[model samples]
Target: MTDETLHLRRLRSPIGRIEVVGDGRAVTSLAIERDGMLPHDGEDESGDPVLDRAVAQLEEYFAGTRHDFDVPVDLHGTAFQRAVWEQIVQLQWGEVVSYGDLGQATGRATAGRAVGGAVGANPVPIIVPCHRVLGADGRITGYSGGEGIPTKSWLLEHEGVPHTVPASARPRATDVTAAELDLPADAPAA
Candidate 1:
């Protein structure tokens, strides 16, 4: 594998400034800038084509004009983490998958907590859509990116799911029908 230097560029967004990092072939990471502000007069795009594509897609997303990302991600993770990330990628737009559901989807029925760990460690947060993962009871749970659970709720809301509520007051999880998730009738939620 060629070792490419990570190139980073800044993109201004309604929520804040997002720093995008990538090699020439694929985007490696996109994270919210800590200050939530962009410089007033500098160039807003990273010159790399891959990063530019990601910026455009993300802009479309925040504007409600696009629902899914098209840019490829050079996701770095352990084998198990990669499996977990794949399931995250397969999640349909506007659909929220519980951590337990994600674990079962990856054939690790008893590894929900482990899957949650992997999800939190995801390198590319928004593009990979780890924010769509929820608790088993439909309650919003741990989110390590940006503003944490609030950020998770924001992303979910952006995707047309208004399931955000304080953890203490979250409603009971909606019935996770087997048909909706494509699991066998004998599967956990089935």
Candidate 2:
């Protein structure tokens, strides 16, 4: 890929520090730092408009003041990956979808594994809402952002989405039925 002028900004959030990268006009990527430290490979331009907007919106999201993001994003990825991310971005704050559901949405109903791969490859996790996806049984399969499964759990909790966390980290019983969680009848047990 050709090198482009990029701007970077880091924001501290409830989860951790997030590093946002933009190409002056639109956000390119958002990386959640595991240890509150981010690699400085781009110019730390605090005044770049796009970076500033992304950081502000993300802060609003973490504060529970923003339910959706409107900042412009220039995602670079394969066509299928882009398509998957597009569908992911349409997810509402409290909504959750399974990998199989996403595969169906993308017209690749049997490509759950491929859909998972695309979700895992999402460059902008929270912005695209990749954490909103789960396994077929409504279990959090895994996460490719921040600290992995724990980060996904925090995001799900923040959104009030009913999901099955690992047994060790679960706050409620794993056998809670859909009715108990107030989910649809067809929803998988939590």
lDDT of each: 0.71, 0.77
At residue 44, candidate 1 shows an lDDT of: 36
- Tell me how far the alpha carbon of residue 37 in candidate 1 is from the true structure, in angstroms, after superposition: 8.8
TM-score list, all predictions? 0.77, 0.82
- lDDT by residue (tens digit), candidate 1, 89-137: 8877888888888888889989977998999999888889898888867
Q: Which ten residues in a row have the lowest lDDT in candidate 1?
A: 169-178
Model 1 residue pairs with clashes: none
Can you give the lDDT of residue 104 in candidate 2?
Answer: 89
Clashes of each: 0, 0
Residue 102 error, candidate 1, Å: 1.0
Candidate 1: residue 136 Cα off by (Å)? 1.9
TM-score of 2: 0.82
- The candidate maximizing lDDT is 2
Candidate 2: residue 112 Cα off by (Å): 1.3
